[model samples]
Target: MKAIREARGIGLRRLAEAIGIDPGYLSRIENGQQGAGNGTLHRYAEELNVPIKAITHEETPRDQE
Candidate 1:
């Protein structure tokens, strides 16, 4: 998440404001100490200009085949 944010040239405070979260909370999210619900994931994707999968780790059935 932090990588994507940095790659997009987005500052912590800027993204936090855009996503309606605190900068410290955003940092925690990026650090993997916290988890985001589906809605928050959408907001993060929208604010970071990335797909939700970019920050999530869901296993697809294809990988098990």
Candidate 2:
């Protein structure tokens, strides 16, 4: 997610504003400290020009097993 964002040259503030979220909240989501709701996820995917799967496929600690 962060990789794609950086590759697209999208700033945190820009993406957050596009997705109607707080920049700090978006940072938390990027850091895995918070989860984004489905609608929010869709907005982010659209803003980043990526599929929802790209953002949703994050490997949680449990998924490592």
Model 1: weakest 10-residue lDDT segment is 55-64
User: Which pairs in model 2 have colliding backbones?
Assistant: none
> Residue-wise lDDT of candidate 2 within 11-63, one digit each (tens)?
99999999999999999998889988999999999998887778898776776
Give lDDT per model, in order: 0.85, 0.90
The model with the greatest lDDT is 2
Model 1: CA > 4 A from native: 59-65
Query: Alpha-carbon error at 47 in model 2, in Å?
Result: 0.7
What is the Cα-based lDDT of residue 24 in candidate 2? 98
On TM-score, the leading prediction is 2
